[model samples]
Target: MLTLASKLKRDDGGKAGRASGASDSTHRVSIRDRLLTKEVSELEAHLPSTCKASFPDEDKLHHFRLAVSPDEGYYQSGRFQFEIDVPEAYNMVPPKVRCLTRIWHPNITENGEICLSLLREHSIDGTGWAPTRTLKVHHLH
Candidate 1:
């Protein structure tokens, strides 16, 4: 859940608190964090009107909740919540997404498992996850 910005801030704090024994490993930022920093901005830019994203902890961009208020359809005017977690190996792997609200949807299970093709790690049809795909794929406008 750590972002590059937070990591940098933490590193700065560590310097002021302790000068020695701070290894380079402690400063290493994950690829997921760097990707989220950019992808998150893109997500906000083109976010659909029916959808809204919230990060409970502003410093953790990799973890957030997405609220979907469908304007039309069987679930029109109803709000659905989803939690997304981008793992450390992101881009190389798909972000983990789970439906927080209990709903009867074909693509989403009651237990929060999602069946989106892009969420899959492998697929014979080539619709599975790819490094090029970003967080924006979850909210197809």
Candidate 2:
């Protein structure tokens, strides 16, 4: 569990930790934190019309919500939710993405696991999902 005060603590770069002479370890920020910040900032600035993101626990930067609603497709008007977890390795390792909304799709399972070529870690040719691949947050059709 997390609270707003703690969330702000890190968001503020632990200035208090420094002032209190706390060990440097407490103030260290990982690469994952920086990357997540950029991603979160970009998403907040230009989120797509059919998609939305919410941080239920700000402390858990790795987890977030992505709600999608296809405007023109078989799934049109249907609300679909996807929980995205960005691993620390990020570009080096693909995020663990799963559907939270139930739907009948060849690539998506009833249990919510998705099997998209791009989302998959490995392809038939033994190639892994490109680390440079763009993250999609809207129109999952």
Clashing pairs counted in every model: 0, 0
The Cα local distance difference test for each model comes to 0.82, 0.71
- Tell me the tens digit of each residue's lDDT in model 1 across 1-141: 224456567757866655576565555557787688778878877888988889988777888999999999999989999999988888888889999999998988879899887898898789999888888977882
CA lDDT, candidate 2, residue 130: 81
Give residue 7's lDDT in candidate 2 (0 to 100).
58
Show where candidate 1 strays beyond 4 Å. Answer: 1-24
Model 2 misplaced stretches (Cα beyond 4 Å): 1-21, 125-127, 134-141
* Structural RMSD, model 2: 3.9
All candidates: TM-score: 0.81, 0.76
Candidate 1 similarity to native, TM-score: 0.81
Give the per-residue lDDT of model 2 (tens digit) for 59-98: 7777888888778879899998989888877766677778
Candidate closest to the true structure, highest lDDT: 1
- RMSD to the true structure for each prediction, in A, is 3.8, 3.9
- Cα deviation in Å at residue 25, candidate 1? 4.0
